[model samples]
Target: MQTMLTTLILGATIAAAAPLTARSLVSDAAGQTYDYIVVGCGVSGLVVSSRLSENEDVTVLCLEAGALDHYEDDILVPYYIGLQPDGFYEWGIYTVPQTQLDGESRHIPMGKGVGGGSLINGMVWNRGNQESFNAWNDVGNSGWGWNALLPYFEKSETYTPKNYSGAEVQPELQNPSVHGTSGPVQVSYPNYYWPQTNNWFEALHELGIPTSAEPNEGLSAGGYFLPLDIDPINQTRSDARRSYYDPIIARTNFNVQDNSQVTRVLFDTSDNLTATGVEFATGASAPRQTVYARREVILAAGAIHSPQLLELSGIGQSSILEPLGITVLQNLPGVGNNLQDHGMIHLNYNYTSPVLADVNDFAINATFNDESAAEYYGSKTGPWTAKPSCAVAFPSLEQVTESASSMLAAASSAAYNLPSTYDDEPTLQAGYERQMASVLSELANENIPAFENLNNNAGGLDLALMRPLSRGTTHITSTDPFTTPSVDPRWLVHSFDYDVMILAMQVNQRILNTDAIKYLGPSYEYIPQDATAEELGQILLSGIGTEYHYSCTTAMLPLDLGGVVNEVLMVYGTNNLRVVDTGIFPMVPGSHLQAVAYGVAEKAADIIKAAQ
Candidate 1:
């Protein structure tokens, strides 16, 4: 008995003497062992780590390049969304001069701090449309339909309704069962607004649009309401760190290292890709060191960096990596393909009344009266809890194009006094087709100028294509993990993408014309009232801005189609390496991306656990 006891004690002492690198708040490879190593402390990483560490034996290490964040004054204030850019927390990635947009580069604000983009974003919380998820299932991403992901959405959320008063003023949250009763994230709606924002909703209804109680309920058709992405108790932005990380910091098995940037994924020589460990830098003054992952390595570096990391680790396009001296492990051509983002545009309105002036103040909030919207939110009411977009309108491009073509044919028949058999007459039909194309293009362009002419203070509707068919590629310029790879999203690369944006702009124009919103948008300002459709098209092409919702860098398609991961989110060639970030999104959702990102991560955690 004495011998056995001594042996056990000696073994523990040796383990104790071993490096505590995993637990080391500041690791210099002192010692540590973990069942799973998750890279990036962003929303996905935080959720994955928290869920993976639930098992007592499965020790999880979460490595973050940034540190803990405080909801600072400017960040907490609703109107201060723009303050984060050029600030410390944003990575501030800019586009490589867009050819279509006068060779001008645009700023793409990416969150570099602890909570990831959630810390710096506009705090809009709309779960993309159900059709989007259904399409995913249809596209071979089985089990990703709206029905399958509903539970996960609830599991990660704590619904906070808007704080509006009066019976007609508030929105109703229809189904309580759809919302998770207990979740880490505190979702709330603010209690205040500029007072006149509801007029915008009224305008939508007058225009024949319906008011949606919960936009997150899988339908994002059209409505006016504040979005929910805040903590009602404190009136602060509800970031992922606050939701998932802060609550689990006390767990002994879960370790987190901030300010540690992972540079590479270490692998053995067998050519068998098992993520052995990671090399990271502590700080400017600290030396880079390696930290081992005993079981598996998960990359949650987001869309931009996930593919970059895969390429750095020899799991991406060989032609690009090999030229730069990167040893290719898996030549996945789809490392960065099918990139998509929302296209944004502003139509400012110079209010005739003093209505909007009150909103300029940070303390001022939007109000919502519906019991459900307010109740689900922490009593903060009004439009203040809503996302910047009070309404989302989904229009089908396929339908619009067909209708436009038919209209052009009809118009030609009437103008030329042609016979009804125009469809049978090839020459006449061809002429009608050409005229129709020209006229549609002109009409599409004409919508932009109408928006510019309305309201002054820059109140233009942002037109984000629910889904863009244009696909671009993401490739690494080098094998170096620390360096950012050459990313060519090829925005507006295809004509269909151009048409999608044009259609979205036209849709917004129609919304403005609707009696429900006419007062909110008064008059178009920027474009000339007499501007032709061709002229409007030029303006849209030149003036449009990005919505900052980038995805599809490391797409999830079948292995044969150059997908980086299989259906289970595993890299095609590796057994233990997985990716759970925005990089895995097969396509961009039709609404705000934050909630959907959380939902995806929630499901990913379960998959990871089951595999273990």
Candidate 2:
């Protein structure tokens, strides 16, 4: 009995010493070579690595620049959504001063740890409108349409129905067939809804926008309760670490090195455009080291960093790389072009009702209460178990405005009638023409939502321009990988975006005027109720910010259309290298990016496996 006890103790010690955390330092894996080296342990990185490591023969290594989450309560609790992106687990990136947004720059928070943006996001799980994905197929990317990608969306999540007895469940909130029952990520509605959400739903119905059956099924243009990526049983935030990484971390073939940043991808000295390995560092003072990739190098460094890495590796335009004294490896002009993000403006209102619950009351109030923490830790149910419930509405151009045709005509003319800058590159012109054609058709058919309204239930309404005609770019000013890139989203540059935002504000006013919402005793706190269109437009200019849905810096269109990667997600000028993140998206889908990012990673895994 004593011998057995000693053996168990020694076994525990051995297990503890085994590098189970997947957070290895650079010194621990200096000379290692992996079958696949994945840079960035974000959603795409985790999903792709987890999938690729399923085959026991293949070794996958993931390098992340941030440390393990350590189960931070702010990240684990769903109600702490507002507090998660505190620069602890975030990159805390800031964009360049926008020329259109009153010459002001905005803070862009991106996830830095194993889970990436999923750890720092609002946890909203939206799969986007089907036509948006079909638009990718229309732009010469075959097999990327909604029908082809729907299965991948289903493959990444396990949906749970909200089962609390006291809560009301709506049939329109979910569709079981469209959601996966067995998957890594957990997605479901909150156990309880804020009292004001029902009023908002009724208000939308009264405003003539019917509730959607299931937003994830793709026809998401209507009012509905936004689904969250939370585990119903545990009542915890279901981020990429909890979903994709935790389950497979025990595999010997999979290794994740945290607090290790990949500086650049290494290539062969030969004439062949072949990627051989990657260079990384432990921290600012640590010496850089090389790690070879036997098969391929997958870059999931996200929209902003992916392009920065490419440029640092001499794969961007000659004009940008030559000035830095970096040899141009590929001269791909699209490496950092076509940046996009959803422009959002918040409208605040004063709730006159004394009995209604304030948004702060749902989470940690002015002071932390031990009893609330006890309630959450003991039963896994309470205010801490859910984020503030909200109602989302996707309204088309025609539904929101009577001047849809004329507005679209004006937008088309402004978009297609480009300046001499576009004339310099036929590829950029072709891509713009294709995007404009699709945007015009969408405006005419009302197939895609032009504006999205999110009712925060706490007298705050968020209006976002779902599809903007404006575009921007991100470029590396220097070769230093640690330096933040110049990110200019150029938001609201075109008058068309201004027109859509103005109409969306009007729609919000109409919703606020509805009998259901008006009964709640709400009054405008920001903009005046009688503000004219011009006055509202001025207010919007100062008020607009990002929805944090930045995408498409390294797009996947045809090479002739300013594409950095091909349909297979491989870089246009390189072999054995691929980008499997939001950067590969040819255009910004009209939804929150987390779910689409997971789907993209899943599909990328299949594509990579098939090629193998």
Candidate 3:
């Protein structure tokens, strides 16, 4: 019973795998002078390079530390989304022992290859709530509100509606005006869904949470079926390299170097402090080489590396640099401060018996996995074409907690404070004051989501902290560029963060008892049932992870507000140097950051183009 949609998608395998012309070796790119040099060829760098190269006279160069992307099934097939691709696609970064998590270090998964996180992330395509983006504007960044950023969000993705589906698996679309019809990134609905998806949505509805038909319309406060970045036609990942680079990479003006790590940005010896070029090396032992940037050097090296690079180049806090015996070029204390991430706690269940109509068999029986693989290879319409969880929702504090009014009241007042480090720095404290106001306001408003929940249809859920009050820092412990940076996310340090997490866990427990989803015969696998708040808090400390939504390390705000970059994304006291990555975010928005990353990069390209 193959449908016509499957036939069309099967015909479109490897649609754009043509050879690219970007320089593959550092030797080829070294000593080369380009109009613009973009560091770290991830999501933001690729888009900036491609958009700038549109002008035939302007030359753009992209430098990536990892090797070029390999389109293997492990990297692209949606079925394998649960297992992270380590060593090749990710940086393999981990945090220092968290004091609040009982001295246990956590892995910080970041992208390494060309497409960056777009290649390794679960392809959940959704946008931030309107209130969150509006907070960005309210905090002094002009032209960055939801209204201003919507065009870029629409301009980045070309939506393709689901052509064929069973009624249960189909999703509702937002208005055509909110989506782009001819953008580069291919965004579409998966051809399949989980077994108990209907029951899951029904359960949320029964609890008074609505189903969001258009989660991308600046309003995503309820349950919605998330889309994937997979190209429906090719039945494979449509990552940044494929969507933004490969098609135009063969252009003579656009050149890229893989397997090259930028050690530092080279600035002129003059008082203006203009960036002249960058020093890069293929490996730690290899000879470092210089590549000149005639106009500008853009740092799109993501949240972790961007701050590391800035500090390595002597543009960070004087206190942090002077201790490491490095001269400070700028005294910006906010270079590696204001770090934020969405901490998640997972609750899984084991079924009492086998259900033939579900995907649970694929996890236990090896033979079932083989059968599913065979079917996926034969015709692209099997369980392998979908992520482990596509049903996601954003719930307000009122939806997840019984004490929303009291919690919001405490958060809004001076009842609690961030970690002590935030108070020591006056600039950081002022900036956090604004962020605290925005997040607390969102927590009180029912239209804004306070947390995110992902349902795997196996009676399991991942509750993520959307508006965390805890703040942390990421800094370089050594002067050696090859050494790993010190990353401290400070998870659950603030009392309210744990309070909300414990409440969210209780809500997940309640969801399992709902009449709509109770028929699954669910039994707890990891989370405790009928446990007191103290017991739940201890378990959360033992096994908490994040959604990998890292941002705000090199935040964008006013100079006096502990900001590393300004409204134009230009670093303070520097000329011709900009950061156009998620690192520039003032706070982690209340959604998966992939869609917003695309929108931010698109808008940044326009801003950079206009500046010239």
Q: What lDDT tens digits, residue by residue, belong to model 1 across residues 171-240?
A: 4454566777588877766655444555555655565545556656765355535356776655556678
RMSD of 2: 6.4
- Give candidate 2 misplaced runs (Cα > 4 Å): 1-27, 163-173, 362-374, 415-423
Worst 10 residues of 1 by lDDT: 446-455
- On TM-score, the leading prediction is 3
Candidate number of the best lDDT: 3
Clashing pairs in 3: none
Q: For every model shown, what is its TM-score relative to the native structure?
A: 0.80, 0.92, 0.94
Worst lDDT 10-window in candidate 3? 1-10
Which prediction has more favorable lDDT, 1 or 3?
A: 3
Per-residue lDDT of 50-92 in model 2, one digit per residue for the tens?
Answer: 9999999999999998887767666777756775435879887
Model 1 TM-score, all chains together = 0.80
Clashes found in each candidate (C-alpha, N, C closer than 3 A): 67, 0, 0
- What is the C-alpha lDDT profile of model 3 across 225-252, one tens digit per residue? 7777878765677788788887886688
Residue 502 shift from truth in candidate 1, angstroms: 2.1
Error of 3 at 11 (Å): 17
Model 1, residue 351: distance off in Å is: 2.5
RMSD of 3: 3.6
